[model samples]
Target: MRTNLDFSPLFRSSIGFDRMLNALEAASRTEMVDNWPSYDIVKTTEDDYRIAMDVAGFSPDELTITQEQNMLLVSGQKTNGEEVHYLHRGIASRSFQRRFELADHVKIVGAGLANGLLTVDLKREIPEEMKPREIEIKTNIALPKAESRQIEAEKAA
Candidate 1:
């Protein structure tokens, strides 16, 4: 089943969020994608995150991780190896490509492959200018130079 979404109302109040909404809509449409390798996403800290994927029988060199803007791409290609006569094969060694949409300020920190699991770390580093800041507000206790001079003259009179 597929459903179309209208974001015209949201566009009136939001700017520069079209890409993100498009990513979400695309993901929703492809909900029936093949679940080749399982994965997990965990928040390690306030600004840190980790993505772990199962890549059994796949080596680190055979996997490729690429980041473009707010999109993260992870793909694996298995190379032809020595043939082994086996009556049954259970483990899957097929090529796959996964796309992950990331939020603003989120970036890939690092990645590692261990025990058939591929872990990718991410961190959200908000720049100093973008971080929340407290603004200092001044009261109306002080007046302009002209007003101060006029008040002084009135006092002298």
Candidate 2:
């Protein structure tokens, strides 16, 4: 069962969050949920992440990994060989494409395929200007005092 949420009220009150809200709305509206080739996302450290996907029947040459500006695309194309009769068809060998949305400054460091698992490593590299900085505070600075002079009124001018 799926429920649709109305974001009209939030759209009227929020500012500068249209992109985020639109992404949420689009995700919610997706009718077909494809769970093929299960994957896992793990955070190894504060700035490092890893994604492991199960691609049992795919080889390195049959798979393609692409990294766009803020997106990561993984696709697999199975090549058909000579037909062979099988008593039981238990394994899946179909073409599939999966997309992952990446955060700002996140980059793909490396990728490897071993033991039927495709592992992708990512690291977040924040720019120097965007990183948080400490500000120095000065204390006890003295200001110069104004000169005061005594003025005597002219006596009986």
Backbone clash count for every predicted candidate, in the order shown = 0, 0
Task: Give a tens-digit lDDT track for model 2, residues 129-151.
Answer: 99999999898989799899999
lDDT of each: 0.89, 0.92
Q: How high is each candidate's TM-score?
A: 0.80, 0.81
Q: Largest TM-score belongs to which candidate?
A: 2
**Once all C-alphas are superposed, what RMSD does model 2 give against the true structure?**
4.6
Candidate 1 scores a C-alpha RMSD against the true structure in Å of 5.5
Tens digits of per-residue lDDT for model 1 on 44-122? 9999999999999999889999999989999999998999997999999989998888998999999999999999999
CA-only RMSD, every prediction:
5.5, 4.6
Worst 10 residues of 1 by lDDT: 148-157
* Candidate maximizing lDDT: 2
Model 1, position 27: C-alpha lDDT score: 61
Clash pairs, model 1 backbone: none
Candidate 2 positional error at 10, Å: 4.4
